[model samples]
Target: MIDQEDLELKCLGLIYTMVQNHLSDKQKEVKAELESNKAMENIYVFKSSTSLVNDMQVGKQGPIATRYAKSNKDISDVVDELQALLSKNSSKEGVTVDG
Candidate 1:
């Protein structure tokens, strides 16, 4: 059987390792949540608009534009614009190599 001091030391070591593991996992979770919030912020920025582009096509199949193009080009244009803005912001923040 292990001595009392040895048992105490083992217990302390186990507790310390458990705390470290728990903290590491918690940090990862928090980081994920922060990233999620950042993406959400970017989405909010994308959606914000003015009366100028208010009539813009929410999707491709609207009424007139899609009736003519009959393609997803319009939506693709908006998505491209958003992606560009995201890219620009990331670039300004020194984030190259867009993931």
Candidate 2:
């Protein structure tokens, strides 16, 4: 099994890359400013939307899930990212991921 700390670094790496690639530095600065306060909210920022439709057609109500981050709140950036990816990749809003 992978060390959890290593996994965490990997996750942070990915998240950092995502934020860097998709968001403007101004946005990153804004997000950084908000991070301290948002951390207190304890909201679950849902990520990773697997298409429930195809599975549902066969019979399934999904999480059909994947974990994008364990740190949920300071996630507006991630949410922004997933939205961009979805818009880029989706047809008929086939991929409905939220976080």
Candidate 3:
């Protein structure tokens, strides 16, 4: 169970990490130029949140209701594409240290 703000933060973290991990400098520059007017931040948030909700992964979070009317398949597709992109390119295993 996650709140909307937490969801958005997760989305931002995922996108930012993926961008840092995958895109080369040239590709990043191209992306900046091509998507200058696009709301990329919101796009990530919307995509992740909608995906979780649609998949029934997000139950009510501590009496909070974070619901949306519409979910975008195109954004979900982008997420899926990103997954494939990461899998195809990523090699190093990551380590996590929890607090």
Candidate 4:
């Protein structure tokens, strides 16, 4: 029989999965947009398109890349902390869930 703890654990797991998926999706979208904009800038520019694209790509991606990495790490750390807490509590109380 499922209990309150089990339900809570399941919900937490689902929420964690959803958050991870959302982050992954957002990172991909951001990267795609950066690439797309860089390409569009190149296409619209006539002179110095190569140099322009290079500059634009770097300027656009630098801070965004850093922010993405930081945000990803932050999310991972939070999820890991929550997972550890749940595991610790479950083990201490001898709680087990069956898939």
Q: Please tell me which model should have the higher TM-score, number 1 or number 2.
A: 1
> Superposing every Cα of model 3 onto the true structure, what RMSD results?
13.2
| Candidate 1 whole-model C-alpha lDDT, 0 to 1 | 0.43
- lDDT of model 4 at position 11: 27
Clash count per candidate: 0, 2, 0, 0
lDDT of 1 by residue, 48-85 (tens): 12122222346454534434442345445555666676
Worst 10 residues of 3 by lDDT: 12-21
For model 4, name the residue pairs that clash. none
lDDT of each: 0.43, 0.42, 0.43, 0.43
Query: Residue 15, candidate 4: how far off, in angstroms?
Result: 16
lDDT of 3 at 22: 55
User: For residues 1-99, could you state the per-residue lDDT of candidate 3 as single tens digits?
Assistant: 236354543332233212233567897787677555464444433223222333233544331222332334435555676665455435334533222
Model 2 per-residue lDDT tens digits across residues 1-99: 236454643222123322223567888687667544655244333343222223323434432223222223335546675676556556455775453
Task: For each candidate, give its TM-score against the true structure.
Answer: 0.29, 0.22, 0.24, 0.31
Clashing pairs in 3: none
Q: Which ten residues in a row have the lowest lDDT in candidate 1?
A: 10-19
Report residue 21 deviation for candidate 4 (angstroms): 26
Output the number of the TM-score-best candidate. Answer: 4
Candidate 3 accuracy as lDDT: 0.43
Q: Model 3: how far is 4 from its true place, Å?
A: 24
Which 10-residue span in candidate 2 carries the lowest summed lDDT?
A: 10-19
